[model samples]
Target: MTKLDDIDRAIVIATQGGLPLVADPYGAVADALGLSAEVVIARLDAMQQDGVVRRIGVVPNHYALGYRFNGMTVWDVADDHVEEAGRRLCATGVVSHCYQRPRLLPDWPYNIFAMIHARDEAAATALVERLATALGPLARGHRVLFSTRILKKTGLRLGRQQGGGTPCSG
Candidate 1:
């Protein structure tokens, strides 16, 4: 990893939220940063090569985009098979994020979690069923936790990514 200079910091701060939605998003960022768009693109390319940027793209607001029903589905899987099951769940396309997480003893027993977005709960549950079939008996049990309201949706924040202190991810 390399220390971010002032210019790099400026670029990071300028594009942290995401590239501008326009015909020339990078150019827009460059204009704001007082640097050439070429420089911005080159820096971003280097960042990706260095693993400083993990992903870059539009993150649709599922709810606003008519994906009205989203479920944070959880499953209690056999410890040895959770990883493979997670991969299968991710391949389902309905799953936006899937990973294994710690479970609280005596209360919460789900070890694997996947987020599913859909137009309705039934549709989301159908995806969960697909995941269950993929996992077979390894998935001992499961539950789809649906949010009743949007209490919070944490937007992108800087300094959360690895390898660099800069904010930009593109």
Candidate 2:
């Protein structure tokens, strides 16, 4: 794994909310980091190449974007094919996130979770069907839980917080 120092990690945390909308976003980040714009850009490029950072893009609120109907489709896939099937699901544009998670005994044990978003519940359901069909019999069982509300959606902060970095007014 590519090791990131404190400065690099700080950069990552600061930019996670989304790059500045201004003409020179990198420059803004550089200003915040007290480094030259060129250095910030170069470091970000290197971080991408090293797999430390995925694509730096906006994470829009799906509901605001007209994708009010979003669901978490959990699947009980065969252990052997879970990885491949999850990858296939992730490859689809409709799948916002796809990963293999552990099952929780009696109540829930679906190993696969894919975030499916659409304009409506019907569309989201249809997309789930398509994904199941693509997986064929590998997808033995599945369930779709549409999100009725967004309790929290925020970027993660790495490193230790001194409790005085950014003040919250409200």
Candidate 3:
């Protein structure tokens, strides 16, 4: 396994949950680490280059935000057309994630799935309509599974930090 130096580990520890929703999140992390922002950036950039940091992406809590209504729109697109369909759907800024997965022939026939978030049910439906128009004939049929509740919401932390997560409770 690749070892993380003290500084890199500190950076990961500070950001495991998320970066502060502030004007300068990197600066906040740097201050916490007692390192300059430039150095923090440089170290993170290096880690990313070396593949230590697999991905650095935003993790927005839509439910906590005004976008309380979320819809998992799944589509049954032609096997040959799903690729083009995914590319088109991705261009539709309303979509947060668009990807294909296996379909159960009997009960579940949908293969493509996209996540859309909105303030209410109607807005979420409207976005689904836009998605249908964007997907065109690539999609044979689709359904929007409206999220009724958020059972659990958390992120997958990589490796143990100085002061890490809690023990699982049965």
Candidate 4:
């Protein structure tokens, strides 16, 4: 594992929620940290290369973007073909997230899960059909579990070091 220095920790905390929405986001963070914009950008790049930061990308709010209808499409695909089926579905540009989870036997048999966002129920259904057709016979059965409410989403957070003040604290 890579160790984070004080400045790196501060950078992580400052932008963990998200980068400032401004023309120069890195500059904004640098200003808050009493550092230069170039330093902040370089540090973030190093952290990303070191795998400390998985990714820094915009996370759109589907509901606010007029995609009110979204569903978690689960499929009961053969264990031997789940990986290939998932790759095919992902290639269709309709799957946001795809994963293979263990089945619960008689209760739940879905092993492959993919997320789809749409403007309405019809669109959601169409997306499901598109994914199913992409999988062809590999899709033994499937289910569309629609989301009912919005949940807060955030990136990983690091707690204050023991016996030490937080990196963001002066």
Candidate 5:
């Protein structure tokens, strides 16, 4: 495991929930943490290289953007073709994310899951049809499971700052 310095820990804590939504997010974080924007960026970059940080990405709120219906389109893809099928689905610009999972026998057989967002149930159904056609021979079967509610989305975070001071404290 990568041992985090105080400053690194602070950076993680500051960003774990999400980056500050501002013109200059890093600068905002640095201003709050008593550090420079460059320092925060450098630290985050180093932490990512060291595997302390995996990925930094946007978590779009589709519902707020008029995409009220979000469906998890599970695909029963042939093991050999799953990778290619997933790549193709992602390339279609319909899927927000796609991943492969272990299939359970008998009751559950889906191995590939992709998420799609639409404005309504009809749109969702249309997207499912489009995706099914896209999958073609690779997918044996599929299901569209709509999300009933929102779930908390957060990143890695520490408990809290131990004491109030510059995160550079050693």
Candidate 6:
């Protein structure tokens, strides 16, 4: 496993809250960390290559942007075909996020979860219907739970900045 030192950890922390809106955002981070912009950019690139960071991008507020309807579509797919079905569902532009999660049994346990968004309920429902048709009869048991409110959405905190040491756990 690759381990990050103080400098690497600092770079990760600095970039997590969305890149600064500037002519040279990475350069801004480098200045904040007292390092050269080239070094910060290089380290971030390396971190991504090493799988330490999945992506560096903005987290847009879809609702504020007019995507008022968001739904969590859960499917109870047979274990053998989960991956195939998931890939197919993800291929749709309407499906923003898709993944296979363990079923929580009676209370939950649908296995497949997808985050879908649209301008309104009707549009979201139509997209769901399209997905169900694509998945065939297996999608008959799927459930769509449209979101009523957003409780929270924030960046993951990987580490702390204490004792002049590396701040993140990764």
Model 2 per-residue lDDT tens digits across residues 32-113: 8898889888888889989878777767788888998899999998889988898788777678888889888888869999
Residue-by-residue lDDT tens digits, candidate 3, 49-73: 8887767787767888989889899
Question: Candidate 3 has what TM-score?
Answer: 0.81
Better of 3 and 5 by TM-score: 5
- Assess each prediction's global lDDT (C-alpha) against the native: 0.80, 0.82, 0.85, 0.91, 0.88, 0.83
Q: Which sections of candidate 1 miss by over 4 Å? A: 151-170
Model 3 poorest 10 in a row by lDDT: 161-170
TM-score result, candidate 5 = 0.90
Best by TM-score: 4
Selected candidate, larger lDDT, 2 vs 5 = 5
What RMSD does each model have against the real structure?
A: 4.6, 5.2, 3.9, 3.8, 4.6, 2.7
Q: Which candidate is the best by lDDT?
A: 4
Q: What is the TM-score of each candidate against the true structure?
A: 0.84, 0.76, 0.81, 0.91, 0.90, 0.85
Ten residues in sequence with the least summed lDDT for candidate 1: 158-167
Candidate 6: stretches off by over 4 Å: 106-109, 158-170
The digit string of per-residue lDDT tens for model 5 on 1-170 reads 56787888889888998999899999999999999999999999998999979988898888788888999999999899988999889988999889999999989999999999999989999999989889898889999899988787775447685753343323
Stretches of candidate 2 off by over 4 Å are 1-16, 32-34, 46-55, 158-170
Residue pairs clashing in model 1 are none
Which residue ranges in model 4 land beyond 4 Å of their true spot? 160-170
Report the error of model 2 at residue 35, Å. Answer: 3.6
Clashes (N, CA, C under 3 Å) per candidate: 0, 1, 0, 0, 0, 5
TM-score: model 1 vs. ground truth: 0.84
Q: State the displacement of the C-alpha of residue 64, model 3, in Å, after optimal TM-score superposition.
A: 3.4
- The alpha-carbon deviation from the true structure for residue 149 of candidate 5, after best TM-score superposition, in angstroms, is 0.7
